[model samples]
Target: MADAQATGPILQLQGVQTHIGPYHILHGVSFEVPRGGVTMLLGRNGAGKTTTLRTIMGLWRASAGTVTFDGTDITRHSTPAIAQAGIAYVPENMSVFSDLTVAENMRLAARTGAIDERRLDWVFRMFPALKTFWHQRAGVLSGGQKQMLSVARAIIEPRQLLIVDEPTKGLAPAIIQNMIHVFRELKQTEVSILLVEQNFHMAKSVGDTVAVMDDGRTVHTGAMAALAEDDTLQQKLLGLSLAAHQ
Candidate 1:
């Protein structure tokens, strides 16, 4: 992984607590996504990883504490305003417009209301299936293709930070490799990424830093390679051998 580029976190959550309706989900959740790298948020199912992503995006109001993006407090910002600040979120549900063509979906994600030719070309290069399916309705795409479209939509406009929830969900091994390649390339552009992923291999392969979450709180933080190399730590924190999880 490249040396850390920024002096501070591109995304920071401090003592953030969230309550969804009657359920108290996040209990003072806190972590940071370092600048210029992929920060993997790993945990077992129901660990509040998805809730954390939603809180960061203002999809869920934090009952306490803060979410700071690029040094600006965004805990109370509207979703659109938060997005305007250059944070793009790709949720597990993907949220692609089923009725819209792939091209239309990309257009909607662009701040200018139209895709930039150069940027579109760049993304198409990374995910050629997207360009091949450009005129097709998003509803018809396979699971992997839909995931690709979700990512493509998030980057239709240049963003300072990108937050994704379980991007490899339901993807085959080949698709996971492709996603890793796309992320590795994106890292070089210096657009920091915060990923919630359960696939241990995917996390280790693409992450520069990692945070382990359990029951809505971060339990460990360290370099990805360190986590990958420590089998005992993996068993202790993740409850399985990292190799076995893959």
Candidate 2:
């Protein structure tokens, strides 16, 4: 990873607030994703992790605060427009076109016309199983393969920041291990990642920094190693004993 302090953040959320109907989902949530590293957004279910990502993607407009990517303000943009601004989001659903073959899904996501051979190579290399199943229908693939296809499709675009929601959800242990390796490989690339993950072990293995969210706001932000060492903080914020896991 690059020197985070020198490059500034790839994505910044400042006092962002959002609501759906009468229900408020985010309240002044703020954090930074440093360039070229995975920043895990750690929180339990219903803590507004997915909501925060959707708000950042502009699926829901923020009622207040600013979102900046690469120094450009994009809080008010639509989802497609925000995506065009170099932010790609992979929602928890894995949104892969199940009817389409793996190759077809990739081709459909190749909106830039010019193929990014390096990016394709990197993705395929990371998930060798994807290359092996290129001609198979995405829907017929295993849960892990679908997740791989989802991530590969997102990375096809020249994304500055990739926001992923619960990538390891509902996967077998073996598949989750493969997904962890894929994420670890992605951290070596230029693209930065903002990951919302429930698997603390996977997150700690791949994430550089961790941000703890609760009740629609970021409560703690620090290096993953430091957070792991703070038993009291881990138990209080994440309700897990990091020492036991370590």
Candidate 3:
């Protein structure tokens, strides 16, 4: 492992633990997402993957340890403050405003609350549905359209790190395949991403690094290609077949 101090992980979680009500979630989870690529967080349903992401975004407080980004300690920062510091998070439950138009939803995510034509055009290229439904209320969009809106909203402006929770969740095979291409394109933008996903095909396609968590802690951290090619290890960690990932 490269020394996090020197290599500069865009997001670093060191012994982070989280507690939700009476249940202790994230028991000293630790991982590093190096700069300029996707870091796939892979695990079973009950693993602390989502908890770790929420903790990083300050949506959940860490009970112990630290989360640092770009040399600043953000473990105790407020959610809005963390967002201001350049972390954009898209949860599995796509949260587009029901009453707002697709354009309006993107405006709300903007720092100045106004559209940037170039950036909006860039986003439209990734999710063409956004362009088609520019004036339509977000609530009327289909599942895949809503998901695309959620992601478009996040990148309406530049963000240092993008943390996405299962972008392919509940989508049709065709939609999922489209998202895989979108993520592949997003990766080429050179922005760091920490993605929590169960779709191994997309994970293998876009991920450069990998982290496997179980029982509230990271059990493995290495190259995504290596994990994608090792069926035995994929089955052991995620009950997924590496052959399917390819």
Best by lDDT: 1
Model 3 misplaced stretches (Cα beyond 4 Å):
1-7
Write one digit per residue (lDDT tens) for candidate 2, span 1-246.
Answer: 345434889888999999999999898998999888899999878999998998888888899999988877889988889888888899999999999889889988888556677877877887787889899989898888899899888887777888999999988888788888888877877889999988777887888998999999899998988887788998999888766753
In order, candidate lDDTs are 0.91, 0.86, 0.89
Please give, for residues 1-246, the per-residue lDDT of candidate 3 as tens digits.
Answer: 347544688888899999999989998988888988899999999998988989999998999999999778899999999999989999999989989998889989998998889988988888998899999999999999999999888888888899999998999888898888888888888679999988777888889999999999899999999998888998898877868654
Of 2 and 3, the candidate ranking higher by TM-score: 3
Backbone N/Cα/C clashes per model: 0, 0, 0
> What does candidate 2 score on TM?
0.93
Error (Å) of candidate 2 at residue 126 is 1.3
> What TM-score, over all chains together, does every model reach?
0.96, 0.93, 0.95
Q: Candidate 3 local accuracy as lDDT?
A: 0.89
Question: Can you rank all candidates by lDDT, best first?
Answer: 1, 3, 2
Model 1 alpha-carbon drift over 4 Å, by segment:
1-6
Give me the overall lDDT of model 1.
Answer: 0.91
Weakest 10 consecutive residues, lDDT, candidate 3?
1-10
- Model 1 per-residue lDDT tens digits across residues 162-211: 99999999899999999999999999996999999988889988999998
